[model samples]
Target: MFSGEEQGKVQIYTGCGKGKSTAAFGLAMRAAGCGGRVFIIQFQKARRCGEHESAERLGINLAQCPQGRGSGPCTSPCPLLTAARDILKEGGADLLILDEIMAAMRHGCLSLTEALSLLETRPAKTELVMTGRGAPQELVERADLVTEMKKIKHYYDEGLPARRGIEF
Candidate 1:
C-alpha cells in the first residue's frame, strides 16, 4: 500500500440534497486543476448522467461500481468497496472522492465496518471526501468536514425531472 503524508483531512457530504457529489467532484477538480492526481469511486451510481463525464474530462482517475440504473440492493456484488480500498492503496492522488457510498451501505450492499476501516487507512496527506445521503453517525464523527444539504426547495416536487447540469 502507498503511504501518504503525515496527515490531512476527511470530509463527508450528506443529507437529502442534490449537490453532494457535485460538491465533492468540484473539490477534486480544483485539486486536479493544480496538477494534483485525483481518484474517484462512485458507488451505486452507474448512470453516466452525473458529473462522471465532467470529472473525467479533468483527467482524474475514476472507478465506477459495476451496477447500473436498474441495479439495486440485491445486485450480485458491491465492487465499489473493493475498488475504493484499491484506490486508497494505490495512493498518490491529492484527493479521493467516494460518491453515493452511504446509501449503498445502508441498503446492505456494503458492510459499514468494512467501509469505515477502508476510510481510515488511506495513505497520509491524502484528502478524502465521501458523498451520499443518510451517512452513518460513525462516519460523520470521523469526518473533519461535513456539509448537509437541506431540501428546503427543489423543482423535483413539481413533477419535474432532473435537468442536465443541474440535478444529474
Candidate 2:
C-alpha cells in the first residue's frame, strides 16, 4: 500500500527448524524502514519474548495473545485467533504479520478453515506474512511465497537454550 501500483503478496514461513517468526519480523522491520506501517500478531504465546520487546522499541503495532499452557487442545474463539480475524477485517497496516499462526491452527487453537476465510477478506494492499511449522497444504498453495527452514543441525540439539536477542 506504500505505492500506488504496489500489490501486496502473501508470504509464509514454516518448517521444523527455527527462524520462521524471525524471518517474518525481519521483513516487518525492513518494511518499516521504508516508512511502511507494520502490524504483528503473535499467537499461542503466553510470555513476553524478544519479538515483543523489539516491537516496543520499533514502535510497531504488535498484539500478543498468550494462550496459557494446557494439556488439551485450545478452546474455541481463542483470543489470538479473534485478534487475527479482527486485524484482517480492519486492515490497519501496510504489512501484517501473523506470527506463529500456523502453529495455532495445528495445535487446534484456531480453525484452519476460518483462518483461510479471514485471509481471503484481508485488504488488497496489505502484505500478509504467516509463520510457524506444519503449515497446511491449502495455505501453502494460497501463499505467493513460501519458505521452509529445514533443521539439518541446530545448537539446541547440543543442549543450548534459546538466547535473548538471538533466538526468542
Candidate 3:
C-alpha cells in the first residue's frame, strides 16, 4: 500500500540509452517492498529475462504482450491492443509499468489515439511508468514526469554483446 503522501502520476523513461527498463524495474521493486501491488506489461517482447524471474520471485503481476511473431516491427495491432484492453479491465495494481509502449506506438503496433485513450482511462490510484526509445512528443507532453536517458557511452558501442543478467 502506498503512503498517503504518495500520489499516482505518469512517469516516462526515454532516449537512446540504457537503464530505462532497469530504472522502472527498480521502482517496481521498491513499490513491492512497500507492500504495493505492482503489475508489469511488457510490449514488443516475448522472451523471459532476469526481470521476469525477479517478478515471479517477488509475486508481482507480470504480462508479456509481444507485438509481432518474429523480429522487426509488427504489421498488425492485434496482440498489443488486445493485451492493452485486457490489462485495463483487470486493473488492481498500485504501480503499472508499460515497458516499450512508446516503441510499440512508434512501430505502428499501437496507435497514438489508443495510447492516449488508455492513459486517459487509467485508474486513479495507479502509478503509470512507461519506458522505450523514440517516445512520441504527445506522450512526453502528457506525462507528469519524464526522464530522457541520453547515451553518453555504452558498452554495446564497443562491439560487446548484451551480457546476461546485465544487459539482458
Candidate 4:
C-alpha cells in the first residue's frame, strides 16, 4: 500500500507451500514496527512454534487458539470468532492475523459462512492478514492482495522434522 493509503485492509497468504505462516509473521513484525497493536490466532498447531514463544518478548501479542493437536482440525468458531469479533468491535488493534485458519475450517472446526463474515463484521478500519495452506478459492478472491506459496520441495518429504529458524 502507498504511504497515503486509506484505512485498514485485507491481505491473504495461501497455498501448498512452506512459507505462508512465515510470510504472515513477517507482516506482523512489520505492523508491530509501525506501532500497530496485533493479535495472532494460530490454529491447528501445538508445541510452541518459535514465533509463539517469542512474539511477546518482541512485543507482539499472541493468542494461539486451541484448535488442533498437531496440523489438523479447528472446530470451535463461536469461541474463536467471538474473540475476533470482540477485538475488532472494540477497535483495539490496527491489524489481526489469522494464522493457519483454513485448516480449522477445512477440518470442520469453523463454519465457512462465519469465517467469511469476518471481512464484513470486522470494523472496516481493521487490517487483517490470514495465512494457511489449502486456503479456499473464495477467500483468495475476497482478499485485496493474495500471495500463493507454491511448494517445490520440502524436508517433510524426506522424513525430517521442520528445521528451527527456517521451516518456521
Top candidate on TM-score is 2
Candidate 2 lDDT over residue span 1-168, tens digit each: 688468888999999997898898898888888888898888766778777787778878887765543323565777766776777788777898988887677677778897798679878888999998888999999999999999988998899887877876
Deviation from native of the Cα of residue 109 in model 1, angstroms: 2.3
Global CA lDDT of candidate 4, please? 0.75
Give the TM-scores of the predictions, in the order they appear.
0.87, 0.90, 0.88, 0.86
All candidates' lDDT scores? Answer: 0.78, 0.81, 0.81, 0.75
lDDT (Cα, tens digit) per residue for candidate 4, span 1-168 = 213355777888888987888888888888888777888877666557778767887688777665454534444443566777777778777788988778777766577786788778776677888888777878877888988899899778889986787665
Q: Which tens-of-lDDT digit does each residue in 1-168 have in candidate 1?
A: 124434768999999977898798888878888778888887776677657777778898888766653355645356777777777888766788888878777667777887788777777778888889888899999899999988888888899986787877
Question: Where does model 3 exceed 4 Å of error?
Answer: 1-6, 66-77
TM-score of 3: 0.88
Error of 3 at 36 (Å): 1.2
Worst 10 residues of 2 by lDDT: 66-75
- Which residue pairs show collisions in model 3? 1-35
